[model samples]
Target: MQTSTGNKPFSCEVCGSAFSQNSSLKRHMQIHTGEKPYSCEICVSTFSQKAHLKSHMRTHTQEKLYSCEMCGSSFSDNSSLKRHIRTHTGEKSYSCEICGAAFSQTVNLKSHVRTHTGEKPYACEMCASAFSEYSTLKSHMRTHTGDKPYSCEFCGSTFALNVTLKLHLRTHTGEKPYTCEVCALSFSHIFSLKSHMRTHTGEKPYSCKICQSTFSLNCNLKTHMFTHSGEKPYSCEVCGLSFSRKSAVKRHMFTHTGDKPFSCKVCGSAFSLNRNLKSHIRTHTGEKPYSCEVCSTSFSENSSLKRHIRTHTGEKPYSCDICGSTFSQTAHLKSHIQTHSRIGIKC
Candidate 1:
């Protein structure tokens, strides 16, 4: 039989779809036949195609042929190399037309688009709770299954993904390559440096339309919106207590489980939260970036500097109705009004 040049010779009669390659048409037929010809020699595993078997072989061989020319970083496959190229080029072609926010990958852009459209394609089979990504839905399934595949080599601590395991490894290595140019502050990851950069630039790009308040991080903005909406999606299965943030729920779980993973090396002090440990480290380093413009006084923390700024601005957003008096700090106002109230109800 003579094949037409412009026509699709291979077609799926079941779905009424056309394919350019005969191999693709053959692969499609496997859905009906349940045939897996390509089997792994190492294990009792079968794949529909030879290409899948070839890619799976690289996991056992640890053969990373594709490498980044700029950093000499290597990956096992060409697809990973293509994805890593965007980090060097800073080319975020996938953009949201609604908010003008760009993402490095199309999948991330599609997830962001769901925020505006309120579309959730991936749903839990156990519950009606939905997610934008299939990976998130898979992770959600683990809550029900109690499956933790990835484990730390040093410790027996298990995680969901290999990338998370790699991030956790940095804590043991004490390798903080991502450094700030202005303050010389180091971070374990590039994303942490990117978030810290916003503090120096004072760039709050993520803004709430309803409240007109802005935040440097999207996660912070989402948490802030919860204050207005009163939406607590993450709930405790044990006690039924809910939290807007996942980290809050994690910390709450620690309260129930009595888990304190973060510890200080200098004094051997333990902290429930990692950020509390980070703040405690600042006391040892004497690294105070937040400084006062009015006075030469500097503070080790941003919150202290924010309180000091109110003294210069003389702007007391919080007021006492009973005493008709105001103070710069909320703590100061609460203390001052304690003299007026009798039943521990300070004005």
Candidate 2:
């Protein structure tokens, strides 16, 4: 089907693909030939199309001409500015018919559609784990390779992607735009605000197939499954120590590096993570919010509440990586290793 008259009508002889202009047809031919005529001056990168090469040049230039009216922040392109404008407008034009959920962008709508359709088209060749989108599959592949391309300009903190780098930039900027309607609790990112809203709505969308237990997010559901499956995917190459979560592995790296960033404001005691500092704060405040529903027994920390619940459920989820031994707590499993291990044994 042809539209109105155009200058040059170029039709593909092989695939029947037609283009309005001859130049577009010539550019399209490079895809089949695998030819990259455009090359980057700064790096060894090459592109088949000239437009992609122009966009790549913006990275070297650091030139963001497009500015936001609301936030006064600049972007490299017009599309990025348009996406930033949606944050101010709160206008979700693209919506899902199945769930009646709306999103700002068409790409995000397509990703959300996979949740309803259960269509995971992209799969990992090594593990056969599926992903809804090609970009997510690319990020998942980086886990296998341990590739961190995005690095901070200030402290040299490395990230897997540009979005993660942007989120990390917020810690330096102190810009929290996403605010809650209920509590007025602000977050640096819109995704963080959406996750915080789940606490108010009591919405647990992600559920386990085995126990039917629910979670607020897909990542939480993934972490919860590790308890049942005993899957420790992230492992230390130095000592062969395994962990269920990636963040746990990152914190454990502090032991090797001797890095303790978290410090108490009340006292001079230092800790590895913010959660440890939070648990330490309970000693001063004497606050025990997590209480047992059955016996009304209170605990200083939520981990204690979880351990106490295991007494009722008889769930010893944590298992040894070396042997087949299981225990309720990870600390207990660590202590149990001494029975089988010789003196001066690492990990």
How high is each candidate's TM-score?
Answer: 0.38, 0.42
Local distance difference test, each candidate: 0.86, 0.89
Candidate 2: Cα lDDT at 75: 86
| Alpha carbon lDDT at 232, candidate 2 | 98
Largest lDDT belongs to which candidate?
2
User: Candidate 1 local accuracy as lDDT?
Assistant: 0.86
lDDT of 1 by residue, 1-347 (tens): 12453566677767756677877888888877888899889985888878778877787899988999999999887878888999999989888999999999887898899999989899998998999888889988888888889898888789876678889889888999999999999999989999999999999999998989999999999899998999999998789999998888888887888788899999998888898888888889998888999897998888899999988898887778886787778898787777776566644
- The TM-score between candidate 1 and the true structure equals 0.38
Model 2 alpha-carbon miss at residue 72, Å: 20
lDDT per residue as tens, model 2, 123-210: 9998899999999899989889999999999789999988999999999989998999999999999989999999999999999999
Candidate 2, residue 129: lDDT: 97
